[model samples]
Target chain A: MRGAVLHAPGDVRIEQLPDPAIVEPTDAIVRLSATCVCGSDLWPYRGINEVTEPTPIGHEYCGVVEEVGPGVSSVRPGQFVIGSFIASDNTCPHCRAGYQSACAHKVGMTGAQAELLRVPHADGTLVATPDDPDPELLPSLLTLSDVMGTGWFAAVAAGVRPGMTVAVVGDGAVGLLGVLSARRMGAERIIAMSRHEPRQKLATEFGATDVVPERGDDAVARIHDLTDGVGADAVLECVGTGEAMTQAIRSTRAGGGVGFVGVPHGVSIPGGRLFATMVRLHGGPAPVRRFLPDLIDATLRGEIDPGRVFDLDLPLDEVAEGYRAMDERRAIKAYLRP
Target chain B: MRGAVLHAPGDVRIEQLPDPAIVEPTDAIVRLSATCVCGSDLWPYRGINEVTEPTPIGHEYCGVVEEVGPGVSSVRPGQFVIGSFIASDNTCPHCRAGYQSACAHKVGMTGAQAELLRVPHADGTLVATPDDPDPELLPSLLTLSDVMGTGWFAAVAAGVRPGMTVAVVGDGAVGLLGVLSARRMGAERIIAMSRHEPRQKLATEFGATDVVPERGDDAVARIHDLTDGVGADAVLECVGTGEAMTQAIRSTRAGGGVGFVGVPHGVSIPGGRLFATMVRLHGGPAPVRRFLPDLIDATLRGEIDPGRVFDLDLPLDEVAEGYRAMDERRAIKAYLRP
Candidate 1:
């Protein structure tokens, strides 16, 4: 088996690695059909996040279950399935309440960028499609594991409703999908904040009614100006930066919500600002597992094309170039065929 | 007219002040039936919040409309009414969305400790009661102007639901009323966090099923123990300190909400903690105007007795004593008859 490993900042290499096996009674072996480089992956690849030692990379994945432990009941070999980046025992109080990312018995999935990946809590973490999805649906189905699910969670957390005016703070893959999620949730107007022309175009294609190229306070001003000074009814904060969070909070109308899914780097929200804005704040590492089943169904029905975010496609062996393309902003996202 | 004025920290004096007259067409002059010293009042008295000039103090009031400007419509002279501490034109987008405290033309009320108060946005801010109430209900009606309304907002913002377990941080008037509000919202178990004996007794009377006399991490641990290691479903943060906010957030389950109404002094929430906790945070100054009508009805019907928090009562000229008692923690709250 071969997998991508990060040796140091800006140093990724594809190396032959030992194949993964079912280690836990609840674990299952997945032969990944596809995987992708996540924006979060850039954090370590760009050296923004410390890379202390060589580590297995990539969490987003979708594939066929190649083997299952005797304890696994929900998913069987030969079934097409998608699981969240974080595996959960799904029956815990948090999981039952749709917050699987905080499940009592949760495990963060890693090493999915390889030919074979071991997924624990198989019965609880993996969701099988109604049947084998068409090959054309693979890209979209793959996103339900993380990005698309995160976007949907942002919209839901922000209380996006029919006839709402929603603003998305980032133009990353998740933010673009947030536009689609808000649209699906019946938001009447969506304002996408992005400085990149290509990403802005993709945002529009995903149902953004308006685009503001400004950042920070300027973006907040633009959103207010667009909404007749009422701000947006809901704002999806897809970027975890302090500036993005502030913009999202300020861009929302009082009583509106800011659903943030970005992994925060150095964000600290002043209580006074939150108090004065009177906006609802809710978000975190998205409980992607909670939305996988429905999102998979939605993708199979061709109701959405979230895979359009993958502007660069690569063979798994050339994973280094995929990381380079995304790190340099040359690709919105890089999809890899394993 | 006579009013309570803060000349400096720890110095509150009743002084002869010019009678307030309608300065705006929407203004209504009310002859105050009662005013009260708030938990927030102690901030300025204890030199926590700067009290620079000899400013007229007191914002909570309930009274009879003595005079109305020509533009006033909904309220007229001789009508008994209760308005929010913050006056607002309830027709704005924020107000229409039930966030009157964030109304476009909002005004923070002050000087209500005087015999007369000129309330702005009379038609939008004041909610007329069914009829003149008995003297016994005056204290409760006065609380609706701030404390009671704030408590109700906390419960509402926390998304309290039937059969849920709720926790309240802070043992002040607002927190006690928050316990009552959660009960009214159908919470099956109400945990009140307090160290004061009297406040603990009052909390139980207000429907607190459990009392945790711990603070900070200990309090968080106690709440989890109370809920079988599952944190409270909803938490009302009635104290604005950073510790209170942190405790409230840590004590709530993932996907649960923390509705904070305390006027924050020095609180900053780390984004990493919020992201990892996956708890929802929503609060601010209570949009009391939105709850006034319903609360007024409930008060008149004798369904709630929030005024029990006012253990000390004084005349208008003795406003200084009211401030002293509250500052020294001798009273949960102080009621003043103007």
Candidate 2:
């Protein structure tokens, strides 16, 4: 099978790799129908993160179950399903408390940029759809695996409420989806902070009431202006930079919350500022497994079409081009047809 | 009137000062029955915090109302009241949302060390008992003004459950009170980290099921061992040091919470590590004003006694000795009667 492999920073290649198989009793093998590049993938692509080997590169996908191991009972072969980036047994205490990303026995799903993939904890990790979704819904369902779930977590963690003004600090696929999540969660006004035309347009279409083209302090000031002199009730820090965190903090009200879903790099939270502002900061990994069911339902019901974030598509053989298009800022996101 | 003032580091003096009078329509003058030295007071006393002028010292006090301004209807002259360190106008949206310390109209009551104090927002800030209590309850009532409220906030913020294990990372007045608060909140097992004989004794008396006399990583290891290697479900960080914060994080289970109330200095939150550990951090200047009434009711009903934290007592004139005793670690806390 062909897969996108990261040999080193800025060195992604479409190379022949062994096809994945169900190695564990709780695992299942699937033929991926759709997959996409993630904003986090760029972390390693930019050389900021260490790439030790030829790591499999994608974590978001929707597929048909080709085969299941002995213990896989919840899902059957040939069923259409959408799973989260983090696969969990979903029976642990943490998973029972709606924090499945921290399941006692959890596994990370990667290398989805291939024709076949192995999903662990299949009985508890995969959420089967009511019916096999049409090919047009493939991209949107694929997004529920990571980006959409993460966006939903960001809104929930920030405690966004009805009639609240929510500020999103990133223009990536997750940020655009965060705007949709906040809107669906009843935020009266959504402020999308972005400079990219494609992302800004998608954000507006995703229910962003306003768009702030500025960055940093200027962006915070614009958010305040849009929020009637008071800052937003919730600020979503979808960008992991220190400046982005600071902006997110400054853009929120004195007693509001900052829900951060960004995989932080070198950013540090200043305890003093957090105290004086009296803002609650709740975030970490997206607990994606907990939201997979709801997100897949939302997508199936056509309430949210997150796949709109993708502006470019390519065959699995051109996986490297897909990465390049997203890396060079030409495409908001790139979809790979396996 | 007499008051304790910090002219500079190591220069706390009790001297005659102008008597306080109502400055606002909602203000009330209180004749202090007792005041005490706090751990935070040592920050400025030890030169860790710069002192610009002779600032009035002490925020914790139990007193009786001497006079009421025009708008003060809830509190009457000669009424015995227990007030939080912050005087807040409870009509603000933030106060309505249960964060009175972050109220739009907030007034600091640090000068409560004086013989008489002018409390602003009297109607909303002061909570009066049905009748004046016996002199024996004075110390316990005083603790409710600051330390007890702060500790309760830490426990509540950490999301302590009815049948869970909790760990407190400090052993000062607030930390000891945290043990009491966790017990009241229904934590099945409370682990208090304290090496001092006096503090450990008080912690055990306050319902700490276990006392771990370790620090930092060792303490976290002990906590994990106590909780079957899963760590505590909740951790209260009452010490504002970097090491204490790290220990609190390491002592909690994955997907747990850390409620920190100590005033942070030079401490930082590592976003990536926190995300990976799945620990949720929530804290700040506690919403003491929000909990004052409930705590005052609990104290009047004799539900708990918090004054045991004070190991020494002296007349107001000996305020200097009180600071010295706390700074020298000779006393857990000192109470001054004016």
Query: Quick one: best TM-score, which candidate?
Result: 1
**Docking level of model 2:** medium
Highest-scoring model, lDDT: 1
State the lDDT of candidate 1 residue by residue for B261-301, as single tens digits. 99999999999999999899999999999888888888888
How far off is residue A253 in model 1, in Å? 0.7
lDDT of each: 0.94, 0.88
Alpha carbon lDDT of residue A325, candidate 2? 87
Model 2 preserves the real interface contacts to a fraction of 0.66
True interface contacts reproduced, per candidate: 0.91, 0.66
Please write out the lDDT profile of model 2 over residues B1-338, one tens digit for every residue: 99999999999998899998888899999998989998999999999999999999898887899999899899899999888788888887777878788777888778777788888899888888789987999999898888989999999889898998999999998999999999999999999999999889999999999999999778988998898777899999998998999999989887788999999989998888777787877888888878877887788788989888889999989999999999998998999999
Query: TM-scores of all models?
Result: 0.99, 0.96
Off by over 4 Å in 2: A228-230
| Cα RMSD for candidates in order | 0.8, 2.0
DockQ for model 1 equals: 0.93
